[model samples]
Target: MAGRTLIFTGPPGSGKGTQAAHMRDRLGFVPLSSGDTLRAEIKAGSDIGKQAAQYVQAGTLVPDDIITGVMLAAVSRQPTSAGVILDGFPRTVGQAEALDDGLAAAGRKVDAVIDFRIDDGLIVERIVNRRICKNCGATYNIRFCPPKVANVCDRCGGELMQRVDDREDVIRTRLATYREQTTPLIEFYDRRGLLRSVDASREAPAVESDVVALIEALG
Candidate 1:
């Protein structure tokens, strides 16, 4: 079965990435994470990645054009017949419009947009307790999915560390930034009647179930 091109948008700690992985495993949607993709490009020292690296090194946001360029290129490389799980990108209305144009040119369009909804307070709590495996990039929430050995990764023997952005203050600021930038993007898809919301405050499996049901309903 051909999968659907899906966009998963939500607050930083809202489990969109986690749920996207579930979709990829069960539904065959190729997971294209914007952060990971950009990092790869930067590591490769590609021209576009070089520009993105400057912004990162300067502690500033990468230009929308560069971001859109990376996204379009990534999308173009994917199989025309397969579905994609977009973890990040189209973070604003401008990118969303650009994505629409890009997909249209490829004769494919986003089949569904899933918004994982959670309150700011809960998000802060979740992020603060979250830890990552430095070696494998696997995430764990101390309150929900803690590792058997404290401060150690279950998957890879790597030491678990809290991300700087997951600190309480940073999370609050990021939340503010997200609300400023992404609210309109949410409205954009909602108006198109392609947006569905799944409560992300629940457990991972429960949220995954809801996300899958919503996508299946899209058919």
Candidate 2:
């Protein structure tokens, strides 16, 4: 079967990535998380990854050309695979248009666009207090899911550290950039009647319920 293509979009720290992860598991969707992809690229020291790292560290959007090329290549490879979920890709109208063109060429289209909505204030608090396990990539929040030991991962005894972008100042910058660059996507997809909103300020399970409801309705 030709799996579905889903675009998950929201401001930084709105738990959109988390929700995408949930849906990927529940629906057997292949997740193409752009942030994770780019981070891996950076780790490998690819040419484009080098370019992206500079912008990412500055809390700025990587230029549209670089981001679009990377995502398009990723999507092209998955045309015949399990359902693919786009997490944190196509943050601007230009990118969306490019995605549309690409999919049209492949006889595929976005099954739905999931828009996670939350206030900027909550986003700051959520991201700033978040920590990740350096070894296993397990995530936790100081306020919500504090670990058994501070600065330690409960699962693997890995050290927990704040992501550079997860710092307070960088989080605020990401939010501002998200509002400026990605917010219009809400209207962009809404005009096409493919946009669905999930209130992401709540806990992950509650948000996942609404998100699942939306995706299931697509059938």
Candidate 3:
């Protein structure tokens, strides 16, 4: 059977990435996070990653074409049977169009776009509390899921550090950029009747339940 493809979009710290992981664990879908994929490529030292690294090192965003190429390649690698949960991709209308073209060529398309709706102030707070394992990359929020020991990762016994982007000023800028860029993309999906939303202001489990119900309804 053909697999469904979903695009999860929202401001940073909305927990959409965590929900993507949850869906992958519970339903066997493959999660393709653009950030994770890029990081992996950079870690692997691939040519694409090399290109991406230049911009990353410069503290600028990776160009859309390069990101689109990596994301399309990522999509093509998975079997048509494993549903794809796309996280942190198609950040622009041009990239979204490219994704549409690429998927159309493969007889597939984005089945839905889940907008994780939350307030910007809440997102800033959430991100400010976020920390990640320096070794294993596990994420935690001090306000919610802090480790057993302060500044230590419970899973890997590694030190936990706050990412630079998790700062309040940077997060506010990112939220502003997200709102500006995602407005058109959200409208693009809405016009296609594939846009759905979950209240991310709620706890993660509650948001996930709504997503699961939406998925079942889609079936």
Best by lDDT: 3
What is the overall TM-score of model 1 with all chains considered together?
0.84
- lDDT scores in order: 0.87, 0.83, 0.89
Clashing pairs in 3: none
Q: Cα lDDT of model 3 overall?
A: 0.89
Determine which window of 10 residues in candidate 2 has minimal summed lDDT.
72-81
- The residue pairs that clash in candidate 2, if any, are none
- How do the residues 5-69 of candidate 1 rate in per-residue lDDT, one tens digit apiece? 88989988788988888878998888888998888778888788888899999999899988887
Tell how far residue 215 is off in model 1, in angstroms.
Answer: 1.3
Models sorted by TM-score, best on top: 1, 3, 2
lDDT of residue 134 for candidate 1: 90
Off by over 4 Å in 3: 43-54, 57-60, 130-163
Local error of candidate 2 at residue 21 (angstroms)? 1.8
Estimate the TM-score for candidate 2. 0.78
Worst 10 residues of 3 by lDDT: 40-49
Candidate 3 to truth, TM: 0.84
